[model samples]
Target: MYPRLFTAAAFCLIAVASSKAEEDSHAIFRRAEAPKEVRAAVTCDEADDIITRDAFAGGWLWQSKCPSNHANFIKAQIFSRDKNGKDAKLIRFPVPRGTPLEEISNVEFFPATREFNSLFVNPEDESVCRTEARWIAQNALKPKLVFWRETKDCDGKKGWRVLKGRK
Candidate 1:
């Protein structure tokens, strides 16, 4: 009788521990809805469906997006906030018109170098274009575009042509 009671108690403790562990796995970051000014500027009536948010160089970067006609495409925008966390400003990526924010655009920021990168790839032909920028200073409003390139032709032989700086 004593041995059976001990076993039951041990099983209940194990079950409770596992349940708590599972609950903690699904972590969430609770942030207020984007400000009215931000929503108006981005033209997103509804609240931001945040894809990613990060803090860098005394400011915050928020990547909000909505789904498009295609599963792989999205209507995305990246907004930045100053050190005081006021006035969200859009970081523009100079891509051609009618181009949706597709998954091929791997937008990422490197903390070590304070550089940001975005790729615009054509799904039809797999041709790629990219933009690279670096934040000049901690109080800088925007990043300086260090490099940008575009691929105009679908032909595989036609390689990427530099847009601004010589590379």
Candidate 2:
């Protein structure tokens, strides 16, 4: 009788321990569910995905995509005469909200100048190309936020030639 009782007690103890382990596992799973901190990290990563590095428009232009519903498409460029001496803001502009950045588009850069251009196409119809896209100037001239040096002979007194110009 004592042997039978001991066996029954041992079986009950094992069953209870197994049930407790299962509950602990469930608690761990509940704690691992995605929290608010994880969501903010995903939101910040999205901005870095907006642009692509593949060159277009005669291999001198880079393509950038604007956020789907933003009011402006902001692009910033840094330029320098030397290969790595210093660089300054070549141009910065905000293409209109519907700038056609999503479609197959191309940008043009003047070979030795700070002038840059982009061909905006109709979002609904790709065939209908628009030569002129009104871009809001972030800065009328190359911003002086970078290292300052003597003005080159090519540049007039304005530090850098800017084109808020139409394509």
Candidate 3:
């Protein structure tokens, strides 16, 4: 009977330790800073608007305007080029409250020359696809080209696979 009791206690302790480890891992990932290139492309006003208005009551955040039905829950960070040819941001949109950092597939930005590139990826598929965006002078649909990508666990481990994107 005493041996059984000891085994049960050991199992409980192990469970608690595992849970704590998972939480710590997530915290580390969440604290990662956005790349400098991406940061430079965003504007302060854009970042402020994203944090203030677009963040949902539950903390889920995404880009405000969806140009098409395919665009939904689209969150992004913008980086632009400085006069020195380095990336600088006018603003930065942070990750929304409830979204896990690991679930983020990609962080994309339009470079100084108006070309877009992915700054980060979890699984690192290493494929680049080019899509075009055309501007409409007065239309609400500004015809902006958006960046899209999917995130997967690097080692096929236990983690969420998400379709992360930005414009």
Best prediction by lDDT: 1
Comparing 2 with 3 on TM-score, the higher-scoring candidate is 3
| True-structure RMSD, every candidate | 8.6, 22.4, 17.4
TM-score of 2: 0.25
Q: How well is each residue in 1-167 modelled by candidate 3, as lDDT tens digits?
A: 99999999999999999988655322111111433343333322221222211111112112221121222223342222222214432222223234322111132322223332333332324332221222111211121223333334433333433333332
Models 1 onward score TM values of 0.50, 0.25, 0.26
Between 1 and 3, whose TM-score is larger? 1
Q: How displaced is residue 50 in candidate 3, in Å?
A: 10
What residue pairs are clashing in model 1? none
The digit string of per-residue lDDT tens for model 2 on 2-116 reads 9999999999999999988655322211212422222222211123333222211212122233333232343323222322213222234443333322221244444333344
1-167 in candidate 1: lDDT tens per residue?
A: 99999999999999999988655432223234555444444544333354344555545555555433231233344445542235766555433334422222345666446566665444354445323322222333445556666675533245667665565
For model 2, the local distance difference test gives 0.32
Assess candidate 1 and give its lDDT: 0.48
What are the lDDT figures for the candidates, one per model? 0.48, 0.32, 0.30
Q: How many residue pairs clash (N, CA or C atoms closer than 3 angstroms) in each of the candidate models, in the order given?
A: 0, 0, 16
